[model samples]
Target chain A: MVGSDVFRAKFFSLYLPLTLYLVFLLFPFYWMLIVSFKPTNDLFDMKFSPFWIQQFTLENYLYLFQNTDFITWLKNTLIVSIVSTILSLVCSIFIGYALARLRFPGSNFLGLGIFLAYLVPPTLLFLPLAQVISELGLNNTYWALILTYPTQLIPFASWLLMGYFRTIPKEIEESAMADGCSRIQILFRMVLPLSVPGLLSAGIFCFTLCWNEFLYALIFMSSGSMKTIPVGTVSDLIKADTLFWGALMASAVLGSFPIAFIYSFFVKHYVSGLTAGAVKG
Target chain B: MAANARLKSFSMRDFFDRERNLGIMLFMAYPFFLGIWLSLTDSMIGRAGQFIGLRNFVDLLTDTIFHQTAKNTFIYALVTVPFKAMLGLGLALILNRHMRFSSPVRAAVMMPWIVPTALSSLGWFMIFDPVFSPISWLFRNMGLISKNINFLGDPILAISSVCWANIWRGVPFFGITILAGLQSVPQELHEAAAIDGASVWHRFRHVTIPSIKGVVLIASLLSIIWTFADFQLIYILTKGGPANETHIFGTYTYQIGLQATEIGMGAAISLYMFPILAVFAILLLIYLRKEQ
Candidate 1:
């Protein structure tokens, strides 16, 4: 009985603070969810109780899709993210494989350079990049973002995949080569099959970064139809006269849901990918 | 027959031995080398400025805006680094224990980070709006103030408000990193310290801090770099408004480059950030090498 009481005391002491911390962290999102359901008048009430719906409505969502360019922005975001991820994967795979497997003289320098490029903040690079994009006559188009984003994405993706690729045993590739496979064939057949999880993680990272990217999209793309979700959602929704809190929150929830869903499904691998790039790099 | 066979072997060996280093170099050249070239020249989009050697640098040196931005950047880095580090550490300590629903709690804690910054900043912007602020309403109701406070209107409050938003967004990074670090520290160390009659503070100071110092350093440095270059949150919230009082280097550069159309000046300002970031990068590399 004494031991049980002691255990109970320990449990509460440890658990209470954790629960409170989580509540604090999660309150904003919960508030967003709640506000999305509330009528516009209730959003700014002083005695606003959280996590409860006095009167629930789906009008906010309906308005976001029907009354705004939310769908167009969504489509633009999807295209940009998907294309960017695929390109980054293809480039990083070739580069990572070379760095991991091939014996080139400047390979180490290239590896270090890639990491340095990754460390170079986009704030610093984006200005120069704007000039370059204009010079290519790609401004005000989705291609501008697709082209410039790789400048940032490639280095990090290559570095990450290089690390993961290095851990793959040489014997597997060597045997594949012995079995009359070309370098490209061996990579496609063996290295790629083994590195799908890493590639997926990298793809997701690229997609999320591109989806949330604001500055590049803000500067590069000017038109409403061309804007990615982050930029589009802001410019299109909130205006000088009125703030659509309900539609805004609904858009926020919907825009974030796909990535959040992807993250939840692959939580462990996602965490590992983040830690591998963040902690180690 | 022997001569022909030897010739075939030599050609086969040559095919295997030839270095195709050109492809990798060619791939990196456009982005890396071209970026450097663009930074050096005074070439703006559709505007011709002379390639006056080092004039941009000289102007950057004398510019008050640049000085203000640099100072602001450093101040931001200083304030945010410790705030996030401590908050993250606090969260990690609280969540380290085995508790019911800990996994869901952990996921909940990460929601802010997973949410897009623009969206969150917009949400925060609404909350800080003068006329409709819930915070102001709450404060007024509680008799803290007589008027609805515009948190982002005044310069001092604006800076603080941006810092608060950044801290909220950034805390999860530290929390997750430090939690991962804390989990890796064996419980045996804590048990051993307890057996030795070490107080909670002593065990934490000795075992916990030392175990996570590397992660702490890496997290802090990353936060510094990230905060130094952060443009979206501040831009969406305030847009360096109410007398340019809240302009950091990143936003200032954007305003100069994109909005004001002084591309050369913007490029110069942007380039100024590189040296500081490079110093941090070198420090990180050295620390990483030492760890290895």
Candidate 2:
């Protein structure tokens, strides 16, 4: 049985610190939620408590939905995230398989190459890539994002999927090969089947990376209708001088909802993928 | 033996394995080389110019604003990394305990990181709003200060504000990765240490720290690299503003390259980030090879 001494130790060491950390983690979200619901007058009023909503309204949400091109931005984001993810996934699966299981020449070097590629952040590449996008006549089109995003995404996906592939028992593939299965066939019929979790984790992680991407989207897509959610929300919502706090916060909430929703369903897979990439790559 | 046999001759497997090479060449290699080339030239948006090797970089050496930005970048990384690493490790330790609602708590803890930085940063933007800031209001109400503290307006406060937001966003990543590292620290080792009459702190310092050392190093190196190249959070929160006090490599590159149409200068600024990051990348490569 727990005594008061043990209880006091647990409370101070565990509960108190954890609670404070959670508040730090979740307070911005709480503020966004409350601010999104408050009317414009209450939003600007200094007298009102920032914690509570005064005369809650949906006008901000309505403004986001109707008065702006939010839906277009959302659609644009979905298309870019999905198409690039699928493209990167197919390409990385082959590469990851090669590095993880194949005995090809220079596989380790190539594997190292892929890992290094992921570390090259977009900030360093956007300027030159912008010129490339323009030269290809893909600027202001979803293709700009769909094409360039893989520069970052492929490496990430390959690195993670390689880790996953290594975890599968090689004997399964050896047995399938004994049954007269070719390498590609063995990959599809045997290797891929046993690695569903890995595939899901890689796919989900790639999708989230694309979804959360900002710099390239902001630079590559300049038109209003073609912008992704992050770029569109920031560029459109905040006008000259005066900030539309409610609509901006609402956009922030709405923009984050899709990733948060997808993540809720795949938290375990995401965490595992994250660790595999960090620890292994 | 297998590698030697396979290395005897080129086969279809080698071709299949090189599948990602073409994409890598086209996407990553091309842009990377182009960025380097751009740094050597005085290229603008509409007009191409002769190669002006190292002038852009040399100009940045003397530029006061770039000096401030460089100093700010180092300050931001220095302040944020230690805080995030420490707090993240602390969080991982706390979460590794036997607790109720552990799954939900873990998920909630990851929310800030899971959400898009471009979006979550907006929430921070609101929280740090000068006139209507809840934090300033709370401080005033608590009689901690008499006047509203300008979070993003003052130069010193602006950089720290950016660092605070970066730490907030970054801690969860450290927490979860370190948590994964923590879980891998076997219970048997701790029990053995305890049986040897070691104190809790001693057991943790010896057993826990050594086991998770690789993870901690990899996570921190990655964090440092990412933080150095970080753009979205600072770009959103302050636009590197209140007079370029908060600009890092990313936002400054965007400002000069895109806004001013100084493509070559922008590329040079971004390439400035490479040498420092390359050191980290080399270390990471060494650690990863050792892991293998």
Candidate 3:
């Protein structure tokens, strides 16, 4: 009688609520997975059960590969994300060290200014940036996004790194200075090696952010070949008169696959970075 | 020779500061000031016009669509933030428990957030399809309604659908951050409160809420700023469609600035988001300083 009661209590309190939440959360992805594999006949058919697949097909994936500029968009997205993330990480490390350890005039004010810069939303800047990019003759090119993304990325990566830098003991740097180590040498040798976790998490975030960015990509890269995945998938796949549901979902699944795969491995570091940045404030 | 020696002494600090500052100027400050100037003019795509100070703002004031958009933006933030806070807090508490398969469960909750908003929103678009919707099919089979419901057809339903998608995307961020805060709260505090004969509600109200207050404040403030300036969900899901009822500042600015080629008016519209965000940023700065 006691064991049965305990089982019922656990079922109601823990298992039931968690199950509901998971269903609510995962059902859309499940739906996308199912619809992407269904043939056009079953996709549009009213009689078929949307929950269960009547038949399986790889037609949508093949169509996405052959019938579109999917490969080019994928390549464009990877290049933009990787290059910008590397640029931001390098800039952030130097600035973050300056503000965190070096005693300089106006450092606190500069730190605050950097954080405030992150608050300037892209929606407010994209219009003026459109003109600025054109005047520089970077319009409809990869350089537009590469140059503009740093405005958001540097502030964020710098702030997160500044917090991480503060947590490392100052005695290590002081001893390095005593041992005739130059400031740059100390940073590259000791500080950089110790904060590898911080660098990884910040880089992961910056890369994912560049991949997910849409507004700037939409505005800057108008040519079909130059477009990133988010912009291309949204603009090219969905036509005005005809909607290709299977191929569209297939693209979404494939586009989100890289970030999802990366995130599953680094969730702990990602979570730590998130709290360290936010709570350390 | 003396000047060169002095330059060598100051070079490191000056170089670091100048390098970072120049990047900020080129990327952030320049665009910001230019946006201000653009809002003051009558510029269009590929053509520059004479300066017209505050005329665009005055004109937007008289435009009815602008008024509707202002209202919609506020509605989006107001409805979504509070719900995200509540649901996120609930999720944190549940996940904080010692449970079976904890890590996988946590990963499952974060999937919506991990995926790109532009793409995951496409999944939502299909779910809300007018015909052949799984939701509609389920509802009809359960005898809840006699006919198919158009999720995006009606103006009110369209905005509601957009808000729902925002909430779904936002809650995981709030949950994960708050979960970090929860873990930092000492386990002894809750256990001590329980030993004092406090009810479950009392223990949570007294012990839990106060400890996590700072985290909650910071998370919600950031969420509010992002939510107010949100773009992707509304853009992909509705495109301010069904007679432009779902338009917010982001989408409306995109339409006027890019689509309509009224760059000046679009800059003016985008500037409206700045003052509201500035207020929250101030509060966040103050809170951060106090915590330190």
All candidates' lDDT scores?
0.77, 0.86, 0.87
- lDDT winner between 1 and 3, please give it: 3
Off by over 4 Å in 2: A1-6, B1-20
Query: What does candidate 1's lDDT look like per residue over B1-292, in tens digits?
Result: 4433332232222222323324434434554455455446675656866666677778778877777677777877778789889989988887787677666666677777877898877778767889767678778878999999989999889888888888888898898899878877899999999999999999999999999999989888878887888899889888886677778889998998778877776777787787888888888878877765
Candidate 1 ranges with C-alpha deviation above 4 Å: A1-13, A44-53, A169-186, B1-45, B60-62, B186-202
- Model 2, A1-281: lDDT tens digits are 56988989999999999999999999999999999999888966777777898798999999899899999999999999999999999988888888787755676678778888889888888999999889899989988988888888888888888888888887776666656667788778878887788889888888889989999999888899899999999999988797889999999999998888887777787778877665765
**Candidate 3 residue lDDT tens string, B1-292:** 4433332353455348666576675678788899899999999987897899999999999999999899999889877888998888988888888898787788779989888899999999999989767999989988899998899889998989998888888888888989998998998998998898999999888989998888888888888888888888899989988888999999999999999999988999999888988998899889988877
Candidate 2 per-residue C-alpha lDDT over B179-287 given as tens digits, one digit per residue, 9 for 90 to 100: 8999877899999999999999999899999987888788888888898999999998899998888899889999999899999999999999999989999998888
lDDT of 1 at B230: 84
Scored by lDDT, model 2 comes in at 0.86
As a whole number from 0 to 100, the lDDT of residue B137 in candidate 2 is 87
* Rank order (by DockQ, best first): 2, 3, 1
In angstroms, how far off is B68's CA in candidate 3?
0.7
| Model 3 global lDDT (CA atoms, 0 to 1) | 0.87
> Weakest 10 consecutive residues, lDDT, candidate 1 chain B?
B7-16
